[model samples]
Target: MLTINKDKSRREQIESVSIEQLVPHDHLVRKIESAINFDFIYDLVKDKYCLNNGRPSIDPVVLIKITIIQYMFGIKSMRQTIKEIQTNVAYRWFLGFGFSDTIPHFSTFSKNYERRFKGTDLFEQIFNKILQQAIEHGLVNMDAVFMDSTHIKASANKKKYEKVFVEEQTKTYKQALEEEINKDRQKHGLKPLDFTHEKVKLKEIKISTTDPDSGMINKNEKEHQFGYSAHIACDKNGIILSCITTPANVHDSMVFENLFNKTKKNAGKSKRAALDAGYKTPPICKLLMDEGIVPCMPYTRAQHKEGYFKKRQFVYDEYYDCYICPQGQILEYSTTNRKGYKEYKSDPKVCEKCEDLGRCTSSKNHTKIITRHVWEEYMEEVEYLRHTKECKELYKERSKTIERVFADLKEKHGMRVTMLRGIEKVHMQVLLTCTCFNMKKLANWIWKKGKGGPGKGKNLEVLLEFFSKVVLAIIKPHLSFIEKWGFVNNLKRAFARFSIFGVLLTFH
Candidate 1:
């Protein structure tokens, strides 16, 4: 018989509920709370708060927890996060807010950031502190790190940009490159190229008027937009050791040193670093080699005209200080240019009638030229390492580590686009996003180690027993009706077999 209950008892009934009991034992927030001591946040933000004068303020710990909750759950905006906290029991419990307690407004964080945290390293300090905890817990492995960069679309519109000529900032390695160039020139019996009188080059580029700090990104067939690039370095466990944000137009190699240095300082020395083709430049390879770190990078395709002989075909004779072409022609070394490349030129008269001239040289004079940087030897060493078994295996971890980190940041943490404008604000967002990721990873790892709650094996057993009992209870009432169809006997035999197997497994 079909019947409808007219009871509204539960809706009108009053009951006592404890927030702690409301949350599950294996909840992520509970695990995070047990694994991490958020009390340290108080010490970090103490100086920012008025100790003796201001009115009783919202706990800085709560404020930080609110943001953590926002990123941990991939909430889109602070406003929505605050709204969630207002109704979410677990979030409120994690934040130490009672059921009736008021949640902070979304604007509270913005005001605090502008007045107290802006221009301060508070966000970075917090990030480092969380990373330190992970290190202490033995969750970080810095032996072989991976590095890459991802572009985060800025909040500004791409069409709201103006073309302006800006003086290109001199490279930080300019002096080093100059000294190396001069040394190489002296070795080649050539005069050093003077760089003192070099003009400052001004390049015209699009600048977003709304977010002037962001640059126009137009690469990899992606949509042209104003954005910022986050260059990140991570350990083998995907714990981010360092992150630096710059304009989207900034090349990955441009920020390699700063990011690498920060990672070294934070996580101690790394034996090897796996990089992508964008970091296969001479200077980057030289930097890693000078630091005694092996560079593992993929093969970068050389840019050349179709049907022409590749640069690799012209083998350099180190003893003779020249290049030997396929036709056995010697391309003698000429002057070292200011850009740190040694120009090797072939004899035009000798190549004017060669059979392979078409493949070798297309110049009007039939001369072939190749340029090699002073640091090309380091890049060659990297290429040599690329063929080794150790480096090949290390390079394979890039997808599992740094690439996955970026994917999580974009897909799960809402980092694909920024709601902020300035570079500093965007950096803060990156730091917090990364911090939340580390926190979740740390918490989950600790939980799986049998510290958060019941072990996985025990949980599985408990679930099995509970489900088995519930099945018996539901079938018990229907056994008489089921027996008429000759199904109860088979069901009884199946449960008996399952119960015996469970007991045997438990004893085993």
Candidate 2:
């Protein structure tokens, strides 16, 4: 009963085994293979390929697929991904490679990316293609978007920084910001302040020599570290619309314009945007309002120090253009400084005998002053929106969308630390990570929801019929009408046609 069967290895003849049979039908690789269209990579990389010169290149599609697999499975390095792909049956199946097909060397990916795809928009195009598919499937809600940024540790040590004096860069929105400030003041019956003479000041900084593009930043009470910040904007459904990377020393407010513009381009007619207090600046609120997006910003933390009366206690009187203090004293407008702050000062003579002088001010003049930005009203408008029911609900989704995205990027997708130096390379990593995320979500959505229940497949039939009609309608239009229309008119017609297509497709 305890005897073991020992037999010499015999070569079996004509076995019925197949690579496809070795892979489970329900495997994730199979799902990805069916859900994603890899053909687009051919077009995306076409220009990089030689038309009639040199040896035939390895398929760029396979190379991209390998990278996607690496990120999807959280493989830490290209070498590991290559080894896994060579041994794994499902991976080989997904990649359209035979078991005996030679996997490319690990250096192949890095070399190809540097020589062919670096500094190109191929990654962005792929990302947008996947996101567009999600949009068609009704997985994204662009009505409201959430924006936030997170820091990723760079490939440099903190101690490897050099101190140097750096000139402050001019603000890109300086002219627009000043114009908005003047308009806001004019609305409140105040004269426009002079901004033609504003001067910028330079400051000293610590630059990292190892990763020169990375910036030295300090968060909370922690020691300074070299890192980069990734600002991301996502739809209410948690689909990332855009991602922008900057040095960690870059403030959220400084990068708002570029990030907002990119998100707007991809988000498709968003009605509102949710942002953290770091984005609660006056210019940001005005920008959102100007773009017809209601700003949902939380209450900014009070700036008053302890033992000082809060500025709210001193209410502004529109009739007198002054602040009414708690002790019933007029704090008249003193001056509009070059920095665009309207400073109000109280009467020291009246305050020297006040009963609550200790709580009011400890200045030798025994008076208090308050400064307000010219665009404070816009900020107040955003603050008011924060307390509304709609805004409160939208703000609650921030954690569910942008925050969770960052958590997944850092904790699961190997984005917590930089694998490559330089901003360009880091950006490439971010794009690839986001593309993989969108791919995973797309696969899950399609597999779980792409097929309707029971007779609902008939709905797909009707949908196909509707698109056929749309094409017919567009073609049936007169050639004379097309010739008579300009580019804008053609764009409008295209949009109208797509709207009709969407209605019919969603007619379940």
Candidate 3:
């Protein structure tokens, strides 16, 4: 049976409906709004604002929040983000705007970004703030850190490069490193290396005309394209602690110390670090050891050459200060070269009679020469750690930590290609993206632990308890003075504002 229903029209009457009522209670935007504390942005940008301004600027907090929403939702551009916010009820509610309020112009974002936030550390401060919140929730472990870098295609074209030769700047640690090398040589009873006759090596590089700070990088059998490398340091739980941007031509080993210094400052002390083969150089291994960090890294490709004995096969005897070969012959130390390798030479006469000579040496002289760096011991230490059961487990976690972070950033956050031209703008983009990532993680964690999620509400309660305990512990040591001041409750309340406690009180 078919039936038709008649419709009637009625005149519209003025009715009121709250934006909060239109949005669902369990929406992601609601969770993000409730979980993140954006008040800090006001203090971060306070100095940029005039006290008696000609016109009150669009709230800095709202400007930054709009940008965050853009990245979090994968909006293509600022204009699109602004347009979407105009009609989206959830976004309007998050930004505290009424149904008919005007959205800021899209150009306002770029102008504010360039004028108010350019050449500033506001983004980094925001990133650190979110990270600190994660720390308070016990979502990160600072005992071990995993590090890696990835290349992002620059905004410049492949053909828009100019070749130029430039003198390389000497490293600030060169003098200290040379001193350490000389000390190591003396300790090994070998003559120190002389740098008086060393020749300086000049290098040539291609720079992009459009983005001069970007370096040229080659793709698979194609022309070189300008790009930059983004180095990230993350904890064992895959939370990024710090990040750095450099030209693609820069080596991973070159920026390691600089990145680690920032990581230490931001993430506190990490006793163990996991890295890939690109960071397996002797200096890197040595620096990690000097800082009391146990490094976990795989062996270099040179160790796996076919039809030859590996370097480890030549047993080094510390007492005799020599290497024992496969044929029971001692290869005595000769000289430490200018490159800091201690050379060991096997007797050619002894090798001539040995049946393993063909397998040992391809040289016409029929003599075997082995070179080991001055910091070879640190490399060996790292090799030992790589094989340990704990380090083997850490390696398995590495793929989940830093590698997964890179995958999420590239696949979801649009980090594979740069929309900004210069390195500074790229840095700003990365900082905002990373900060949003941490915020999202923190929000999801809070939401999950609140109800029928993994920890079943126990996690949230525990986190709150942890925050309270930390605050109380800091005050308890000076209980007498605190009691004298009569501000114990006020102190607790003030610290609560910085943690999830305040949010818990507001919502729960």
Candidate 4:
């Protein structure tokens, strides 16, 4: 039975509606607004605005919120985000716009960024603020951290690159390496290698003309392209503590110190760091152990030719300072190179008479050489730690922590490929994307705890209690002086004010 009725009620419907009412109660935007405060943006950008300006400008918070929407929802472009906002009830409510209020033009954010936000650390401040909020909420666990880098394809053609010659940049650990090398040479009764008049070497690299700041990435059997690498450090809870951006050609080990130091400053010292094979170098292992942090890394396969004996087969005799080959031949140590490797050469005459000469040496002289870094002891420690129970368990969390974070950023935050050109712009993009990612996590955590709405005092009591305990623990030994100075009452008042107004209040 089909009854066709011509009803145009949709075209004639006119009932008063509230934008807030149109949005659902459990929407993500509502949770985000409830879990975090956006008022801090006013103080951060106040200097950028003119008080006695010609006209009232759009709220800087609104501009930032607009970009947040673009990344939070994985919208492809700002124009598309604007269109979505204009039609989305939840977005309109989040931005505090009325049903009929005009959504800002898509170009408004770009114009504002170029004029007010360019060359500023505004995005980084926002990211740090959000991360601090997470820390305060007890959402970050810095006991163990995971570090890695993911490549973002640059908006450039692969074939439009120009090969250019440039001076190779010196490594950050060059001075330290030279000192260690000289010390090793001194121990062996040899002269230190002179580096005073060493010339810088020139290297050829491909640069994209369209996006000169991006470097050509040609690894992992992927198509060659210009791209940028985003190095991120995350806690066990998958909360990003710090991020640094560099050209894609930069190795993970090169920027590891900067990234780790930044994370340490923000999140305090971590007990351990889990990394991949790319960060299994001597310098990295030494850096972590020197800072009293255990480094957990996977087993990196030794680089050897096919059908050749592995390096491990040669037993290193530390007492004699030599290596014993599989055929029981002693390879005596010669000299340590500037690259920090101690060379060991076998006797050509003895090797020529060996039955395994073909399998061992391909050189015309029939001599086999093996090299070991002076700092190999630190690498040995790391390899030993890799087998320990604690490190093994910590290393297993890498897939759940940093890998999951990279997947989320790419699939949910539009970080797979960046449309920006320069390193600075791409850095800002990464920061904002990570900020939004943290916000979502914070919001969901709060929501799951049954504190989802605005002004609900989300974990305020818990924070206040924790703060009181920490304060007492720090000043317990000085209680006599506090009592003598009549500060006990003042301390009580301070606690009360903290419980009321949070950390914004200070005792003067």
TM-scores, one per candidate: 0.88, 0.83, 0.81, 0.87
For model 4, the run of ten residues with the poorest summed lDDT:
499-508
lDDT of 4 by residue, 309-335 (tens): 888899999999999999999999999
As a whole number from 0 to 100, the lDDT of residue 464 in candidate 1 is 74
Give the residue spans of candidate 3 off by over 4 A: 1-15, 168-173, 187-200, 218-224, 303-306, 349-358, 364-366, 452-508
The total of clashing pairs for model 2 equals 0
Q: Write the per-residue lDDT of candidate 1 for residues 159-211, one digit (tens) a residue.
A: 89899999986676889999999999898787777889998899999999899
Q: Which stretches of candidate 1 lie over 4 Å from their true place?
A: 1-9, 454-508
Error of 2 at 134 (Å): 1.4
lDDT of 3: 0.83
Lowest lDDT block of 10, candidate 1 = 499-508
Clashes of each: 0, 0, 0, 0
* lDDT (10s digit) by residue, model 2, range 1-508: 6987676454555576789999986678776777887898898889898889998888998999998888877787899999999899999998888867898999998999889998898888988888888888888898998999999899998898888887786676778767766775675677888877766687888899999999987878767899999988888777888888999988898898898898777757689999998998878887889889999988776887698789889898867778989989989887665556778999898999889889888798687887877667888788788899999998988989999999998787888888689999888788888888877777777776645322335686678677768655664455455446644354455555555544533322
| Residues forming the 10-long window of minimal summed lDDT in candidate 3 | 499-508
Using TM-score as the measure, what is the rank order of every candidate, best first? Answer: 1, 4, 2, 3
Q: Which candidate is the best by lDDT?
A: 4
Q: List the residue pairs that clash in candidate 2.
A: none
> In model 4, which runs have C-alpha deviations exceeding 4 angstroms?
1-6, 451-508
lDDT of 1: 0.88
